[model samples]
Target: MMLKAMTVAGFSLFALVATISLDASAQQDDNLIPNDLAIEAYQGGWRSGGSDPTKECLAHFNSKYPTKRIQIISTSEESRKDWKGHVEYKYQCTAAIKLK
Candidate 1:
């Protein structure tokens, strides 16, 4: 009986820690959204192309959320397309922040 009680207590403690860890990680993870409306700023043939979506998104998140350390991982990015006087580009980025 004592052994069983100890085991249950251990399991409960582990479960509580796991829940806290998951909650912390969820809080750290964030979806990046660029403040600038024009993620792909290439307006016309004469205009220069926009910055890298992943980097831009990372910068935006880092700047917006001040933290000791942060890591940005680009989950996926859209294909780049270009044509005469026209361009279409898009991408997505995610950020994982660490508290130092």
Candidate 2:
């Protein structure tokens, strides 16, 4: 009986540790971007154009949320057209900001 109780206690401790670790990871992810609207600047063409969506996204967010630490990843711009001569320029970027 004592051995069984010890085993149960050990399992409970392990479960508690796992739960805490998962919760921490969830909280970290939540801090990534607070508002979805702020990410709109880098949507659609912005992303396809090879422009780093992070920069445009960060800029948009910074305009409204100056307090947030916004960081943009590498950005690039490219043009691609079909054989029909339909030309379109696009911008893409990725952004990360910390929430207060």
Candidate 3:
């Protein structure tokens, strides 16, 4: 009976450890990285005639990290800015995601 009890306890411990390890690894894989932000603007924050810089950011991350992906978590903020003489829409983004 003692031997059986020990075996059961050992199995339970193993199961607990496995659960925790999986959760921990999952958390590790989900990395919070910056630069996923995409802003619609000119090349120099000018009023208009630019593109999203964050697209390159995400692409770079994808190329640098194998099997990892970037997701736009949020559009953190947005505002209107006057550049030179043009009124442009500005956006601040919060981005995070990863595969490992």
Name the top lDDT candidate: 2
Q: Clashing residue pairs in candidate 3, if any?
A: none
Residue 95 accuracy (lDDT) in model 2: 60
lDDT of 2 by residue, 1-100 (tens): 1222224645742222222236777787776546532333354352334344455566666886798776675455667787987666665565665665
For each predicted model, how many residue pairs clash, with residues at least 3 apart or on different chains? 0, 16, 0
Ranking by lDDT: 2, 1, 3
Per-residue lDDT of model 3, residues 1-100, tens digit only? 1222225645743222222225788877786643553322222232343545455445544565546556654443233655666555444444455444
What is the model-wide C-alpha lDDT for candidate 3? 0.45
Alpha-carbon local distance difference test for all models: 0.48, 0.55, 0.45
- Model 2 RMSD vs true structure: 9.9
Least well predicted 10-residue stretch by lDDT in candidate 1: 37-46
Residues 1-100, candidate 1: write the lDDT tens digits. Answer: 1222225645742222222225667655753643332222211122235756666666666676565355655444455446765654555566555543
After superposition of all CA atoms, the RMSD between model 3 and the true structure is 13.6
What's the distance in Å from true for residue 23, model 1?
18
Indicate the residue-level lDDT of 3 in model 1. 25
Where does model 3 exceed 4 Å of error? 1-67, 81-85
List the lowest-lDDT window of 10 residues for candidate 3.
38-47
